[model samples]
Target: MASPLKVVILGGGTSGWMCAAALSAILKPGTPSSILDLRLIESADIGTVGVGEATLPHIKEFNDFLGINEAEFMRKTKATFKLGIEFRDWGQVGNSYIHPFGTFGQTLAGVEFQHYWTRAQALGEAASIEDYSYAIQAARGQKFDFPSEDKESIKSTFSYAYHFDAGLYAAFLRDFAEARGLKRTEGKVETVALKPDSGDIASLTLASGEVIEGDLFIDCSGFRGLLIEDHLHAGWEDWSRWLPCDRALAVPSERTDDFPSYTRSTALSAGWQWRIPLQHRTGNGYVYSSAFISDDDAQKALLANLDGAALMDPKPLRFKAGRRKKSWYKNCLTIGLSSGFLEPLESTSIYLVQIAVQTLIALFPSSKPGEPIDDKLADEFNRLIDIEYERVRDFLILHYHANTRTDSALWDYVRHMNVPDSLTHKIEQFKRRGYVKKYRDGLFSPPSWLAVFIGQGVVPHGYDRMADTMDDATVIEKLADMRVRIRANVDAMPDHADFVRDYCFVPPAKVMAEVSK
Candidate 1:
């Protein structure tokens, strides 16, 4: 019988537990029983940022991959279903739009649907392009339902994610991982020891003076990257220029009687604020630049927006929005905030963690170190992750850069700032022809771009020429049919708050009252 290799994971936040969950699910009953001696170490003394309360739909795949029941998962996490995000006052004050997860309509005549809609709008025969989106209708109507039938029907055309309590989610994953044979150790790592010859992490000594050894180390340590950056000397990539918000104040409030199934990102003077509704409570936060906005003002802004009674005091958090130069270096690999961080504008933190763990599993090395694991393999893994990060980064920047709100210095700067060439080209293409071209296996597809671009007031100059093949009246009628179908379906959905209470409500599974010392 073969022995299981020792797997050591540092830190116990969402990233750590996600890694544990994935590894446990795959390696628990490998070919032979007990083939993975997985151990996770984290300190109760350390605090997690705990602000990524919203998620992308990709999380469904992760949970499914782990055999998690959706209702049960949501119940445990106090999660609320999310169809998309509502960007309020982004293009200008009092103007809003939704960035949904589904398509605009079927691509038209070998040309995109958005083009035909754009042409109709130019011809004064159409409403906003958003009118054709089923998700937009459902979100606006505050409805929730799973597509039990034809997904192509406007009766079931939208995709969804979740707004959950982060701490509860970590605890849920921890339970899942532990149940699958992963060993967890509670301690503070005092020092990270490197191999004398290679300078690669060989072991970590705990505050109790006990040493834990492993051939490979997974760093889930938050911002500090204790092992990956602090000890390993991995460099940091500063993306503060492109993403300026650095400080945030997060607080939870009593659950509102009416819970919408969508997250809200309201444009603020220096940054933006997020409103995430969970079954148990409402999560609100003001993410902003300290240089431009005072901490007191940030706190005040967060407090002022509460729709319910305060559950707790505002928690302050600091961050730099960027990734490490090399997420994988030597024998240690960094995931989560250790790897990099983009603002949670689109609720991508969990997805990033999911991607990293999946990538690590796919690129899991041979038991013997320095025998087969090489830079080429690492490079390939990092390149995919790098591109994914860059893509998400560009998407986030578009939310800020494409806005027409230039009333404040913050907005003015972001409005006139020079964005990445990649983003610029995407905008140019979309505006020129109402066309969106996605990257090779990209995270955001054409519809995702269309939602944001059109929402942010990027009106196209012309529709696709081929779209002209469709008569204007015919196009308008088809679009109207889409709207009618969507409205009927949305009106039939169960109330979001009611659906959650019946299906996925958890009554305070667990709460961390304080940071352990």
Candidate 2:
């Protein structure tokens, strides 16, 4: 029998623990046929960048794959449901719209609903596109409920994500992974040793002089990229000229009575601010460019704009906007911030980590004696990782480039600066006919693109010719009907706070205890 492939994950935050849990669950040891020996090394002195409070609906799939109980996870983590993200001023000041998690209106005559809505607008109908989305309506009404299984029903049109404490989540997964037989090392890594012949990592030496050997290394060491960059010299691909926000001021504030069902990103003078409400408290942050705004001013801005009393002094985090040149090189794969960082404008940090872990598992290699590392697998893995980063980069750029805010140099610069040809092409295509660029795999879907395009005032000059085939009266009537049905469905759903209280409410004493600790 071939020997087991020893997988050593370096760093312990959400990424490392997630990888550990999944690997331990899928490849349990104790049998000769079992193929993986998993261990995660995390240091007590190192702090994780845990400001990722919001998430996309895909997190549910990740949790389900690991066999975690949804309610229990939510209760333990102090999580709140997220229907979608509400943008306050990206298009222009005082203009608000939500990028929902589900589709807008059902297709008409095999054509997308946005095209029909565009045609209706040209015919003197003036309802906002937001009127036809079930998710937007639910979000606006502060309602929450699981989607129905009936595909034809409006109640089934929307999906949900979560707002939780990232630190608690990592701890929860630590317990989970350890229970499944994954070993944990508590010391900090001091140095890495490489093979002279292949330059692949051979072992990691800890500060205590204990050397741990492994066949494969996974780097989740945040921006430093200890193994991937410091050791292997994987170059960085900087996108700062496009996404110049280099600093963030994150702080938690007291929770309020109004627990909305969505995250909120409001445009600021030099950058933007985020409002993420968890069950225990509200997570707030100002992601801004230091070149344009001083750190002192940014801190003051964040403190002034909070929803409630500040729970703690604002904490600062710094980062550039880009991914590593190669996510997978030789035997080491970079996940999370080590691989890349696109701002959490759309809550994609966790999703990126999830995708990398899933991709790695799919292309897992054997490390039998004298077996060479497969170049083909590494190449394919890098290709897939590139697609994920570039696609997400373009989507985040759209949020800034498509904006109509011109109050500050920051907004004006992003609005007029030249974007990637891929993004420019997508903008032009949407401008002409409201057509969204499709992809085989990536984050944002058509509904997501349409929401930003229309919400940010990127009105198209024309609609799909097929949309013209529908009579003007029928199109208007159908849209009006959709609006009515969406409103009714949202009205029937329970209040967001009430639903949370019933489903996964954390006890006040437990929450306070965690806070005190």
Candidate 3:
């Protein structure tokens, strides 16, 4: 048989190590029939952009695939459970709502629950839509429990994610990868050499005069795109017109004893502030457009709004909202910041990396030894990546475009700015009659769209004809019943903080003592 494929990954933060750990586990490095020789290059001198503390539910699947014990991982990373995101003052000055990780309510008689709710709402017999979601109720009550396996139970309706320290999680994955026969080199790359004929990456020269060659190269380099853009010149497609927040200031504050189980995104004067509650500290940041807000003011705002005493000074970050023209180019693939950066409004940063790794494994190139890698494989991979990025872009745009905040120029501009036709169509469909378009792949099932649409005061003018088949009184009774059931189930769950302490508590004192060692 031919020799195993040599795969080299550059950079070593959350993205790089996640790729390393997942690839090494699935590709099987040291066995007689090993399919891959995995290696990673990262520098101790370089610092990573590690402020992404909150995540979506998909991360659970990634950890399970790596055979990581949840309790151990949580303790190591100081993670806390996340039910969903709570939006504040998006629609208007005093408004608040939650975009949950589960359904709003069960469908009734071949019609979506939204239509029935809409019909009941018009008759003045319905309550707020938030009442029907188990996840929203649990998050609001500061309660959490693992979803039940029984489908009939209201407790089984919701799913969960986590808020953890990005730096520590990367270290955790580094240990896992290294223990599984994955080689790691400590140095900075000086130059990337390309094959004269095929223009594919031939090898990398480290600053220390060491040369490393591989059949495939993965770029996890944070915004610089060292290999994908700096070397290969993969073009960037900027989406700043719609997503104008180009700068951020992140800092950690003292941990709070009464932290909630969900992330909080409050609309600020110029942009927005994010509060992510991890076990050790609360992650706080302000994402704003440079045109609307100065860096100094942004920093001050973030520091002033923190819930507890500041732990450290803010770390400034700069990024454009967009994706690479070709995520997979020649013999190199780009993941994480190198591929694209959609701001963490919905905490999708890690989920994007997870999806890229899974998609690459599914479409890994196949060729005989000494044969050229197929361009068709690259084409398919890029096509899939485009679908994922575009879908996520539209979802994020919905949050800004649907808002009615007139307190700031930033809000005014985004509220009236033209959006992508795809997003416009979805909004129009929902407005016409509470109908949400479904996708075969990518983020945002119907429930997510419903949450945002209804939350932002984009109420529909009509109901689906199918919803009319049910009696109005009957629909109202069903909606009330769902609210009661959701409340009953949510009240039974333990307090989020108490549950976390029992499940995976790692005292800050213990962590500091270990560091002191």
Candidate 4:
């Protein structure tokens, strides 16, 4: 039998355990056997920025890949269902829209329902596009239900993610990985050493002077990129000009009885505030550009707007909105914050970690022990990482640029800023008609783009020429009918809180206290 490959992962946050769990699943497929010897080094002194509470629907697939039981995982993490994100006051004061994890109404005559909706709007016969989405209606109604498997069912249109305690989630996955033979070493990494010839990471020396070596190094260290950047000299790509919100003040507050099914991002003066409700408490944060708003003022704004009494003092996190020039450098692969950062506007922080780990697994090295590392495989990994980061970067930029808010300098600057030509072409194409550029693979589908564009008041001049075939009366009638069906389906679903209780409730002390009232 071949000797096991030694895999060393630095840092132990959500990213570390996610990598450990997923890698364990991959190596021990079908039965419990190890192809890789995995060990994670995490420090008690180092802290993780635990504000990533909300997630996209892709997280469900990651959990399923690890063979996790959804109900058990939710209970352990204090999670709540997230059907979509609701943007409040982004277009104008009091304006609101939901970017759902689902499609708009089903195709009308083989054309996307949005084109028909656009035609009806031009004829002054349509309602807000929000009325035609099942996820949006259910979210607005504070309802919850697992998506139906039946393709023809309206309830099957949407997918769901989760809002959970990031810290608890890490611990949950720690138990999972540890049970599957993942070793955990607790100590601070004093220094990282590199090979003289290859320049790849050779070993990490602990504060206690213990040297640990590995064939492969996974950097999960936050922001610092301890191995991938600090040791290998992989460059950081600054994206502050495009995504300028460089600081965040995160805090937790008491959970309220009304647990909405969607995360909310309310536009503030200089930036935006996010409200993510889990079962135990609500996670709140104000992400702002320090160039525009003072840190003290940002903290004040965040505290003032929370849904309930603050549970802890607000903790500040500073980060640039960009990624590493090369996420995979030589034999070291950077995962999580060590790799790079794009702000958590769309809850892509955890999703990005999942993608990196999954990508590495797909492009796992084929070289035998004691052979040279494959440069071609590492380059391919970096390429995939670049595509994911850039695609997400553009989507986030659209949120900042497609705004109508003129109340602050931040808004004015972003609204008029010179966006990338890629984004420029997309917006122009959408404005000419109701169209969205389709991707073979990436985040943010057509419905996602449509939600943002139409929600921010970007009205197209024309519909798809194909949509013109439908008469105005017919289009209006069908849209209205779709709205009726969406509302009825949403109305039939259970309350979000009640569903959590009946399905996978974990009665934490705080949650129980809130429920008693």
Could you give candidate 1's per-residue lDDT for residues 286-396 as a string of tens digits? Answer: 989887999998888888888988888999989988999888888888999999989999888899999888898888875553332466667877888898899999999
The digit string of per-residue lDDT tens for model 3 on 300-376 reads: 88888999999888999999999999999999999999999999999989999999999989987676534678999
What are the runs in model 1 whose C-alpha is more than 4 Å off?
Answer: 29-35, 149-151, 369-372, 507-517
Residue 394 lDDT in model 4? 93
Model 4, CA-based lDDT: 0.89
* TM-scores of all predicted structures: 0.95, 0.98, 0.99, 0.97
Tens digits of per-residue lDDT for model 4 on 1-517? 5667788999999999999988877785223345688889999889998889999999999999998999999987889999999999998888999999999988988898888987887788888888889999999999999999999998899999999989888998999888878889999999988889988778899999989988889999999988887788899999999999999999999988869999999999999999999888899999999999999999999999998999889999999988888888888889999988988889999999999999989988767655667899889989888888898999999999998888999999999999988899999989998789888767789999999999998888887899888777888888888889888889889999999999988878765663455
Give the per-residue lDDT digits (tens) of candidate 2, residues 350-412: 999999999998999855733567988889999998999999999999999988776899999
Residue pairs in steric clash, candidate 2?
Answer: none
Query: After superposition, which runs of candidate 4 have C-alpha atoms over 4 Å from their true positions?
Result: 29-33, 510-517
Show the lowest summed lDDT stretch of 10 residues, model 1.
508-517
Give stretches of model 3 more than 4 Å off: 515-517
lDDT of 1 at 66: 94
Off by over 4 Å in 2: 30-32, 515-517
lDDT of 4 at 370: 55
